[model samples]
Target chain A: MRFRTRRGIEVVAVADLSLDVADREFISIVGPSGCGKSTLLRVVAGLVRPTTGDVRLDGRRVEGPGADRGMVFQSYTLFPWLTVQGNVEFGLRIKGMAATERTRLAQDYIEMIGLRDFANHYPKELSGGMMQRVAIARALANDPEVLLMDEPFGALDAQTRIIMQELLVNLWQRTPKTIVFVTHDIDEALFLSDRVYIMTARPGQIKQVLNVALPRPRSLEVTTSPVFVDLKRTVLSSIREESLKAISLTGTE
Target chain B: MAESNTLRPIYRLGDDLRPHEPIPRSHYLIIAAASTLSLLALWAGLSYTGIVQPTYFLPTPGQVLATASRMLLDGTLAVNAWASIFVIVTGWAVATVMAVPLGILMGSFKFFEALFEPVVNFVRYLPVSAMIPLLILYIGLGVEEKVAVIFIGTFFQLILLVADVAAHVPKDLLDSAYTLGASRRRVVTRVLIPATLPGVMDNLRITIGWAWTYLIVAELVAADKGLGIMILESQRGLRTDRIFVGLVTIGLLGFCSDYIFKMVHRVALPWSPRIR
Candidate 1:
């Protein structure tokens, strides 16, 4: 009886939320503050266990965190003790890859990220933007099938975030992989995602899916275009409805 | 007289000391030196001019310096200083060996934390000085007793501090490591250890300083050697100057060890944000 009472009062974060991505597809989840978008991403990353469902990757169920899916967090999670090259080599080293091979491979990613000169510099010495760039490089070096990014540029200032977005788009174009990006920012989602899943308020379900038809080899200037503006307006209206619902729900709780 | 309107920026404290803003290093050094020199002058006047009128209890700075040199020449200072240093090093080493693993275990798992934290929290408050009588009765008054006192003094505190350092390794760090294919064991070795090593070094530095103080307390009763006993004997004969000498020697030793630890930290963990 006590258990049942607790269950009755429990706040559901996300429910009835099913999603899919094609191979090499780039999708984004956008919603209001408490709509459980990050929770949705965590569910996919296998960092959190879903109450009554499973996450399958290439037909194999993801029971826990693994090398096949790389995660980039909002906070720069690069190991402070490791250098840029060392950080990029982390996953390969864990797999017991030989030092010589991992070093060369890590160096390639470092060069691609424009951090070859700072390969030996510690994370503490780098600026926030540079640190986030290293985090991106570290995850991509493993060559995971899918990359899960949870508002990875949320901490960066506007200009740095724009530059990081361009860098990511260029990298994605060069080496296509399935990407699931989570952010509340409409423009960020519209700019990078092939498909955007706008979620409803608490007990989150998909409200709408917007297909971004923007051209590839995309620059920061695309955000100013009319097509991008229309998509942003649509996403903003959907997100505003969810935000109001979330606010009213909070007042009661 | 009014202060100069065109004073140097360093002298304009109203703006210079606003929260996180720091003064120039050279200016800081000069101010620190001036502060210490002024305090030394105050002490000199109070003792040398007999202002307090208790020369035996409050020896002049010159008198204490004379005793220091005399003791150094006779090698008595060196012998007792060495004795205290030995206990501190041995006891600290033993405690570190035991505490580090236990700390990591307690920090890593809830089971180990449940096993250790309550007992440690209870015992840490039971002062080591108060336990000296029991320690003396059980261990007898020898090197073992002194070392035990220092161990007891440091281990409980060290374990808790080390555990805290380990526990506070950010969740995202371990999360990122896991997603990058680190196994459970790999998380401990690669993520947890390196992430907590800098903090553990800081904890060691802090605990070693406390261990120095414990050595004096350990040597307080029935000890024939150590600077603590020298002070104890000096009190018996009212040789405050010699007591002052012993205190100065202990202070010097502590200062040197702390400086060495700092230098080692800088060299070993240059990546530490605290150092940067």
Candidate 2:
């Protein structure tokens, strides 16, 4: 994918980046800053059309954004006017679901996210953790086959990010949707995804694909395990080298 | 605030001047009342003491009050006030009905923006008051003529402001809607409208004040009735007290309308932080 800077100079954001994910699998893309990991995710979500290549989801060429692919951004994108319940029910309402049915469905997700008590509260009234949880519920309520998340927990404090990572895993286990998670955090990618796709510095490409050998029903305690540490070491070292390369390349430019 | 005392009291001088420090409701009310009373006192002192001189030019507060009561009891004040109110509201409402959808289109679609923005940009800056002679030639001295003057003053300005409010709808909100399987039209209806309505209400609120200004201008030349006409006639007769009555009546009407608009905004959009 290419973008024109405000000065009207054209630049490649992501180049020749190809990816595939199995249904019900959780995959993550981790890369250095400005490596187009976020751009790649947007291309897949069909928010931006790639300049050279195309994105395919289940044998269908992705042309524009659709309900089959759900997106959660790093920013808090909740409609400020909407209550937690209203936001969760947004897609369903667009699909023309009846009031009773959509409300019931929204209530189920609201309960699952543990925001049942604050379902009527506006996004402004919620904490960072609570709002992201509502965001996750809002995307999941539509029941999209695939969820595309771009650094979803990047804005949170360290403690909150860890908690959200764990909460997401639990949510995924119950619902079982294909999730393509993007983050700069090596540990987050390794802990949450079945496979981690590491990318090179901009113009971004898949540098290495690592399969996570961690067991199911994993807990935060498992992060201290020897196998988890070994995987974390490899992901960390690879990301560190790319980050250095990214900085030096920009310095030369 | 004075650390030398080693004891900080609950309230101190300039306490509320610090950024976002809370002030008690009663304290706020007292400050508000004090400022208003002081202004009135200043006005009364100037006129009653004849310091501003020529009692007709700067009439005493009591004289103005007497004139106001006389006009009120005779019912001409009600008739004139009603005429001005009706023309402004009717013209403003007509502008809103036509401009809102057009403004939405202009903001959302580049084609519409390109088509409409240049003309609107050119026309809005052309002074409305300068067009009065031309308007009088075309429409004569009828209520429709008065309404047309207000419409011309307001419609172009209202369209542009509403367009700005619509244009500022967040991209994340639109993207999220599209990803949720919303069609383009549905995004406009569901995402754009709800997100922009609070700002649009604000635009309507602000433009109504401008419309009130235009009503006075239109009434001054083009009408046989209204607060503006009363003010004009009183000036010729040199009844400064009656002119003051006209001024106060229009001020009261404008304040009431603005207050009502604010109250409606608060009630309709309880989620907004501007009021609640």
Candidate 3:
């Protein structure tokens, strides 16, 4: 996919990128900054149409953003004018669900995210971690078949990120949906994903795909396991070399 | 932990600091009361000391208060106050009706923005006061003329401001809404409108002040009733006390309307940030 910026300069973002995510699979894409990881996610979410090639969901060509897919951005994208309940109800309300049903559904997701007490609280009243949880609940309440998260916990503190990661894993288990998570954090990608697709820097294409054979119901302690460490070591060294090449080519380091 | 918190480099100077956390409502009330009393005291002192020389130029606070009461008793105050309120509210409401949709269009679509932006910018720069003669020629000396004055004064500036506010509705939120199955119209009515509401309310609050600022110009052209007319009549009669009464009444009315707008903002948009 290529994009022309406001300055009218054409830049190739993604090239020769194709991957089929199995039903109910959890996939993560990790790459250096400006590696078009987000661009790839946007294509799936149908927020950005690729310059060439088509994105198909359920054997149908993806035309635009639809309810079949939900997205959680890196930044806190909860509508500031909406309370927790209001935000969670947004998609359901748009879908013309009855108010009582919408409220019940929204409340279910809010409780899932552990923010039942703050159902009436506005986004401004929430901490960053809490707000991201609202964003997640909002996306999930739609009952979308696929959830596209663009570094959802990247804005969080380290401690909060870990807690959020665990909470996400738990939520994923309970709600079995295809999730395509994009992040730059190798550890986060390793911890949460069944398959981690690492991309080359700029004009991004999948360089490697690491299958994490880590056991289910994994905890933070699994991060210290030798198998996890070995995988991390291999991924890191490969990515480090790609990252160095990226910096040297761009001369932006 | 306490020592570390205290010793940490404090970056509390900027407006982003949530320094005044959860102060009681009554604390604000006390501060407001004290501030008003000090200003009143200052006004009284200025007049009593004869520093504001000649009673004709500046009436004493007591004189103004007495005149205000007398006007109230004679029913002139009520009549004129209602007249002023009617025109301001009518003009402001009309401006809001016209500006909001136009602003949204201008903000959302580049084509519309390019078409209207230059014209609006140019017209806004032309003084509303300067356009009074032309407005009178077109709309005449009735309340319509005055309403036109206030409308012209606020509408242009408001459209521009509302457009800016609408444009600032975060892109991510819009994208998120679209991904959530909202149609284009749904995006506008559900996402865009509600998201920009608090900011638009803020814009309305400020432009309402501008509406009041244009009231004197509106009434000065030709009007038998209203605070501006009251002030003009007083000035002609050399009744500085009554003029002071008119001025104070306008100030008091402006303050009350501001309070009303704020109350509306709070009640209508409870999800917005609390003032405290």
Candidate 4:
């Protein structure tokens, strides 16, 4: 679908793609910066409407924001004024859920993310990893069918990023919600996704979709495996080729 | 064993040092006593030698204190102070009630901001004291006129401050709330209001001081029952002691009110950045 911004710039993001994401597929869409992967996820979340395409979940056209899709942002977008528990209860409160039920639900998810001791703490008191966990817990507490994460761990240091990546993999393994993660990290895409879709830079189009044949319940150790290395090399080469093509067209390499 | 002898001097010097502890209440009493004594000594020295005029230009500190006590006994000081406080509070409350919602609206909506901001900026730059004659002509020399004076002065300042604060709420926070299924009203109340509260509190703290300045001006307009009226009356009669009393009372009240607002702000927004 093609979308034009208010600035008269055209965004031809998803063009003629016919891939069905199953009920709980963890798909990652990777490209260089400004490739509209985040925009595509936002479109799926119904935040921005496509000019000439349809986004449907279970054959129903998505309209406006709904409770069925939960989004976690890269910036750890927890309301600073609210305690961790309060932030998690925010979505439930909007649904007119009772206080006791909301508290119970928030507590369950807060505990699930191993933040029970820090439930009363505000977001500023948390480290980056803890804040992102709170953001994840907040998104999940609403019990959405699809979880949309836009570079959720892009801001953390390498060590914390690895830890959060593992935590996310564990969470997905246990709960198994359909996740569409957008990232510029090649290793991150290969490490966590069932299938990785690489896109061309700018006016982004899906260039290649590679299925990672890695076994489920993947661990950090799998990154060193020969198969994982081969997949990484292939994805890297595809992304490099696309970037080189972009440079040639723009003449700014 | 020979090196131990040299270390003994350092250890002895450190051993006499005591751990720091909070000052005891008795220490406050001693400090207060010392301050009063120093002030009394200075005043007595100035009065005995006639270094300054005692009655006309500079009243003796004793005379000012005596006048203040006499006014307190006659119940006039309390009444006047209360009247001034009532005017300030009513005017400030009305101004806040009008300013906050309007500011939030103008801050959130682009069209409203564009329409009202220029007008607000224009009117805000006009000296609030310049409107006194117009206010008196319109509302007469009554409590209503004084209130109008105070409201005009306080409202414009608060609106600009609150609107600026509201305009700066991070777009990511708004987007996050919206994506979480928050309606527009919900986003305003839950996210926008809370995010802008610290800034609003800061404006309130400033506006309270402005309210005091306006209260004095408001009382200067044909009123006979406030601290400002007392000062004017004393100046007319050349009662310098009573004038000093009024000035001291105004200064103390302004200081106390600002301090009280600071305390309340700190308590209300505990997570806000600590004030120095």
Candidate 5:
């Protein structure tokens, strides 16, 4: 979709992009910088309405943000004012669940994220990985049908990012909630996703959909596997080609 | 990012940069006491040496203390302090009651913001001291007039402060709130209000200090029975010690209220940076 800059220049963020996300499937969208992976996730999350086309969830047109889809942004977006428990319980609280019930539910997710000790701690008090874990728990506490994460580990240091990816994979294994994970890291996409969608830069479109045939219960070890390495090479080359095309089109590099 | 991986020990010792690990409370108390005592010592030294004609310009600390005791014993200090506190609290409360909602509305809705931003901006720049004569003309130099003056001094500035704070509520936070199935009202209440509250408390604390600034201004053309009036009366009699008492009284009161505000902020916003 085209967006006008403050200077009124038309920038097409995404165009001619169409894909069906399967129920209970873990899908990752990987692309170069400025690709519309995040925008696509936002569309499904019903945050920004598409200018022309419609996003359908369960055969119903996505109208606006709803309880069924939850999103975690790249930044540590946990409300800095709230304790970890408070942040986790935010969605359940908004859903009008009774205090005791929401508290009980939020505690479970907090425990799942292995932050039960820090449940009463504020977001500012936690490290980036810990904060992102809370963000994940917060999203899942509402029991949404789909979790839309936009490079949620992008801000974390490399070690933290790997740990977060493993944690996410473990969580998905246990709950198997439908997840639309968007990232620029091809290794991350290969390590965690059931299927990886590679998109072109700028007016982003899905260039390829590579189904990761790696075994279940994937770990950090998967990234070093020959199969994972081959998939990564293919994904990396496609992304590099598209990035070069984008640079040529924009004529600024 | 990789630099953090060096085996350098990560010190968890509380410092200014890390709000999560605040410096201990006793240390803060020590610092505060030391600063207060040092200032008092400086004043006492200057007066004892007759640096600026102690009897006329700067009263000796002992003489000021004697005057304070006299006022306290005669109950004049209590009456005037209470009156000033009453006006300040009432005027500040009134300003908060009105400014918070209006500011939130202006911050939340573009239409209200567009409608009120220019007007509020225009009025906020107009000094409250400049409006004293006009306020007296309109309200006639009564207690109501003083309260009105304090309110006017605080309200417009608070509105703008609150609006700016509310406007800056993180966009990611608001979007997350929306995706959580929060209605517009809940987004304002649950997210925006809570997120902006620490800043609001800080702003209110500052504005209350500003109210004290306009206290003397408010009393300049007004009736009696306030600390400002007490200072004015003392000035007429050339009672430098009494003037010092009044000044000290206002300062002490402001310090007490600031401490209370800090306490309230601590209780209300546990996530915020604490006293160090």
Candidate 6:
């Protein structure tokens, strides 16, 4: 696939790559800020208009925002007026699902996110981590085939970020959805991704795709393992080299 | 271990209590009573010394109370008060209905905002009282005229308020809603409207008070019945006591209505910051 900006700047100019994501593979795209990771995710979600590329889901051209792709944003953007249960059920309500079904499904997802006790509490009442959990649950409640998370844990504190990362890994393991996570954090990418695509600085292109052959059911302990360390080193060096090149280019300009 | 256990006394009976906590209710009551007593004593002292004549200018508090009791017994005071409140509430309702939708539309769409904002600004700058003669000319000196006066006073105020609230709906929230598959209608209803509700309620409070002021101005014309009319009639007849009674009624009614609206706001928007 290839794409260019409306201003005629080529963004992802040459990309003949195929990722054979199993029904629910976890893939992470890691690069510096403004490297089009978010743009690629939006293109995959069919939210952005790619100038020269087409996204195919089961070989069908992706049309528009649909149930197949659910997005969890960086900020916990739960509706402030709605209670935890209400926010989770928003998608279902829009689908014109019956009241009983909506309630049942919302309750089930609320429990899944460990927010059953806060079902009646408004979004403002929850902490940042709790609110993000609600956002994640809201996206997943629709049972989408692909879950696109755009720096979902980017705003949380370090301790909270690690906890949320563990929770997301567990959720992905249980549900088995094709997950495309975008982040600028190398360690997070290596920790969470089955495959990591290293991207160049904007206008971005794929620099390298590193397969993280680390064992499944990965834990924080794996972060210290030799394999994880080697992968992290590889990703870090790739990003550093791209950033230095970008800096030199800016210096010349 | 002992030092840590006794690090600091968490409770101190004499010094830890906040100034407002220990005797808030009693302190307020005492201050109010003292102020009232001093005012009454001053009035009595002036009257006794003949420094000011009560018959022409200031009426004694007793005289004002007696006049209020008489009107109450005759059912006239109650009727006039109810009439004034009814007119103000109706005008407020009409003004709110007209302003909110227009405000939301103007706030949401940039083109509509540009087209109508200048007209709104022009109308808002015009003194509401200046419209009295025109309203009277068009509607006659009837309930319609008074309601129109009240509506004109409140409508523009509410329009600016609601528009501001609608315009300030957070961009991040709207974007999230779109990504969640919410349509344009859903974004307006779910994301924008609810986010702007606190601002709308705040404007409603201000407009409600303005409505009362307009009611008084409206009655200054030819109305035979309302608190303002009663005040005007008493002034013409040199009945200071009756005038005092009407003025007090207006103050008390306005205060009570504002209090009621505050309670309603608290109930409706539970997520909003609590009033201190």
lDDT of 3 at A111: 96
**Against the true structure, whose DockQ is highest?**
1
**Cα-based TM-score, every candidate:** 0.95, 0.93, 0.90, 0.82, 0.90, 0.79
Tell me which residue pairs clash in candidate 3. Answer: none
Off by over 4 Å in 3: A80-83, A97-104, B1-38, B274-276
Clashing pairs in 6: none
Worst 10 residues of 2 chain B by lDDT: B1-10
Cα shift from native, residue A182, model 3 (Å): 0.7
TM-score of chain A of each: 0.95, 0.97, 0.98, 0.95, 0.97, 0.91
For residues A94-165, could you state the per-residue lDDT of candidate 4 as single tens digits?
Answer: 989999999999999899889999999878788989999999988888888899999999999999989999
* DockQ of prediction 6: 0.43
RMSD of 4: 5.9
Candidate RMSDs in order: 3.0, 2.4, 4.3, 5.9, 5.4, 5.6
lDDT of 2 by residue, B203-233 (tens): 8888778888886688867577898888888
Over A1-253, each residue of candidate 5 has an lDDT whose tens digit, in order, gives 6677899988789998998989999999988888888888888888887877888888988899998998999987898878999999888987789999999999999999999899999887889899999999999888889899999999999999988999998888877789999988888888889899999888988899999999988777877899999998999899999989888887886
Candidate 6 regions with alpha-carbon error over 4 angstroms: A1-23, A34-54, A198-201, A204-208, A233-253, B1-67, B231-247, B266-276
- For model 4, the superposed segments whose C-alpha errors exceed 4 Å read A1-20, A240-253, B1-74, B233-244, B266-276
Model 4 chain A: worst 10 consecutive residues (lDDT sum): A11-20
TM value for model 4: 0.82
What are the per-residue Cα lDDT tens digits for candidate 2 across A1-253?
Answer: 7898899988888988788899999999999889998888888888898777898888989898999999998888898899999999999988889999999999999998889999999888899889899989999999998999998898999999999999999999999999999998888998999999999998888999999989998889888999889998888899889989998988954
Query: How displaced is residue B44 in candidate 6, in Å?
Result: 9.1
Q: Tens digits of per-residue lDDT for model 4 on B1-276?
A: 897687565333233334674455766587789998998788667765678764377777888899999999999999999888888888988999999988988888898799889988899888877999998888899888888878888998899889998998887788778777888789888999998888888888789788988766888788979888888888889998898898888889989988998898878877664442
Q: Write the per-residue lDDT of candidate 1 for residues B125-244, one digit (tens) a residue.
A: 998999999998998988999999999999999999989988999989999999999998999998998898888888888888999888769998888899999998999999999998
Which pairs, if any, clash in model 2? Answer: none
Q: How far is A160's C-alpha from truth in model 4 (Å)?
A: 2.0
* Candidate 3 lDDT score at position B121: 93
DockQ-derived CAPRI band for the predicted complex in model 5: medium
